[model samples]
Target: MLRVKNPVLPGFHADPSILRVGNEYYIANSTFEWYPGVEIHRSRDMVTWEKVASPLSEKRLLDMDGALASCGIWAPCLSWSDGLFYLIYTNVRSWNAGAWKDTPNYLTTASSIEGPWSDPVYLNSSGFDPSLFHDDDGRKWLVNMEWDWRKTGSHQFSGILLQEYSTEQKALVGPIQKIYPGSEIGMVEGPHLYKKNGWYYIFAAEGGTSYEHAMSVGRSRCLTGPYEFHPHNPLLSSYGHPEIRLQKSGHASWCDTPDGRSYLAFLCGRPLPGTLDCVLGRETSIVELEWRDDWPYLKPAPGEELFPSGAVRNWPADSFEPPVVLDEYRKKGEFPPATKSIEYRFDGSAIHPDFKNLRTERDPEVYSLTSRPGFLSLRGGQSPVSHWGQSLLARRQTDFSFSAETKLEFAPTSFQHLAGLCWRYDETNQYLCALTFDENLGRVLKVLTFVDRQFMHYDPVPVPGDGPVWLGLTVQVDSGRFRYSPDGKTWRILRPVLSAAVLSDEFGGMGFTGAFTGMFCIDTLDYTARAYFESFKYTVL
Candidate 1:
């Protein structure tokens, strides 16, 4: 009975939020507009997971400048008591035209969860995945998911709410209470609250994260509720079961181990074989939860021999082995040794400190390891359609027959300047295979492509850029090819191959996002143009 690798925190890790503490386990997700905002992970025996720290780093607990690509951090909620370490998020400021308007939700604290975390306590915009419940007698509650704007009716997702939180008036006190309304199965949003035995649970996230999405539960012995719904309610869902390749499973969180065993760290998706697309977005998986008469169940068993058996087979227990290919930064100052380093999540603010020297976080000496000493400088901002400062540095294409290489030293005069290789699936769908300097093809090499977010195509290729250049991207699932190499063993396929299902979540923006093959440098006219990288391979064929 082993076998557990279902996106155990891979790629664009979505709205998770699992925690344990004693023997160690912790999870936190949803970093919409990227940045240094929420994205934590650590695991002891629940199948190897890495990445820790980053309680919205700072910038006043996250500020994704002009946040747009899926908007800022949402669904955070990580907790621990006595020893302290609590977090509550949602900073989605306007989700485009039809309004989701300035959703502001905050709350932070940390004694150690690998954080210096402490500033940010505002909480309340009346909606969006917020959770915090620690009651035995000490009381404290927050639970959310009530965002109704009333345009015509059909209960605009107006359900699930509860308040009363005041650790001595750190705020959130009184009148909000609505309680259960979800499971009618629409887009119910990610809400989490637990308290077994005497019961008070309410794990949510209903259909609408794409491929119909799901994961529901409800109960209440009065934490302010009349609740009771879970007569076989999607304790976990793969939607219509699409032959099970781990399609869009629901947003979940639950942990228990030290021997009692009861794990579940949800949010799944690994599509691209019979099409549901999902290019590695919304990951983090671990399941094994059985309670019985009190209701919990999700232990069908059998299924684990993973090398991407579509995802979730579970590994990392025989001492913790992580490293799936190359990341050769030469252990410079160490830290990214967990799954073979790359995790540079940044869309804007809160990444300063010589960019954490590497392991995650960038933008200081632009991104250097001793001024090109070992190479990797990346400096350029804005113009990935601007979700603010897109110097971009990615990781998480898991494996569709992978093959990603990088070796650059960019030198361009200005075609709005550039820097290569990308695969994005947000800020206006993406594809960019740049290396520009084209005043009519002087040192060209383009690809562009955007699809559904407009833009269409570009496709140039003159070459002879006078220096470093060997960008790549391979993929073999929904087809994505883009390559180049003046010398690195000869390669040059650029013609029209991209359609990695458009970066699937069904097809770009709003399917909840997934798809992020790294490296970017856009400089819509210099934000102090900079770009330098070397040896960043990724292999898994």
Candidate 2:
């Protein structure tokens, strides 16, 4: 047996929809408020995974212009049938509108996983987390959790709805039905259907997406019927077990290996020590499943008690061992030295796949790789706090301890034009070490930190000559600081250590995404101000 570590896909990879096609496995996750929506990863042996593609890469496929933080993409479901890959996702237009949630579902299909996915076909706005189920009889159905604003508390989640999808018509037809009203645990969502041995099984996430989150299942003899809840209910959950490293465990998708072994890919969160803040956001973890008496249960390791008395089995962080292992799988190896570091030279025709723009589409007016040939040219648009157009390009902060460095060249005539490296969680919470022109000092570097929407500015440090300056940020767990270098080697601390804890879900009120580190250019005076970034480097410490 090979011990596979938990959180196989770390750093903000949430709402995983796992599927196995032949020998390859693919997991699609939600990219909320980030452009190029869904993030998909590919795996061969279930233990090793790598980012393969982001299907929603064009403006025609996704348009989230003024979407608030964590309000663009939600629970994406990926499936395969009839030689085509089917992807169902929800475009959340409004989530903060008190009692109303304007969630519109859409579907897109492609013959290949890494593909030119077709334009999205509007599905419905009654709910979200929609999934397409291809029945063995050649009929396709869609299942999603219904949302009712009139209802209060958990009742707002309503029930799971089932409807027939006409592939030939490219639309949904026939009458819709409410299959399951959900269990006693409310806030039901992320529905997925599977059939085995004349039994129709429906899996869903319940108890909300917080600490009480869980994975529940129900089964019935018919496709849509009075489903019976699981004998123990919530087949997998980490609730009431704060000792466990993986918290907020729910929103799962299942798949079976070629050897008939069953596994689940679920979203989980890792909170900082002594706090409920998950700076890395919700990640993806895998757990094996066992079927007995036609019901599924989390399979525990030999002599290990799995969810004993509604409590999950605790594993020490130092041990780095999980409670379950995959039999006949190869031993897990350490990540390569090169895998810990990434250096983008900005010489390619397009930005690296690891980098993603905030909210808006990849407009050439805001950013261009060809404008400066060897450098990434960013034309500053709005201020960082604006929800609309902001020239910000960043990547996920995958490690608790890592460093990011970038070289920026910009001639700012006034303080309104700025460009630098940033550690951003959202518009309201971020630390920007920017370069701008001061009245007394020529071009200077200043560190601006925002905590819970409150702003704090540090003293400015003047630059020596008229040349490109190097800016860097290093984070070690809960604390981080900014630095600068003139020759790309010798560096000086630009600001005092600040709390990185603010860049988290708990600290950033109403936030669901994780922290990111990248380069940003802001010009409040005019949208035409340009800044050039020669290179950007990120390394895991």
User: Per-prediction TM-score, please?
Assistant: 0.36, 0.95
Q: Write the per-residue lDDT of candidate 2 for residues 245-331, one digit (tens) a residue.
A: 888888998988888788888888888888888889898888878788998877776666756677644221211223233443324
Model 2 stretches astray by more than 4 angstroms: 153-155, 306-339
Best model number under TM-score? 2
Candidate 2 matches the true fold with a TM-score of 0.95
Clashing pairs in 1: 3-313, 4-313, 4-314, 5-312, 5-313, 5-314, 6-312, 281-514
Error of 2 at 213 (Å): 0.9
58: Cα error in model 1, Å: 2.6
Residue 193, candidate 2: alpha-carbon lDDT: 97
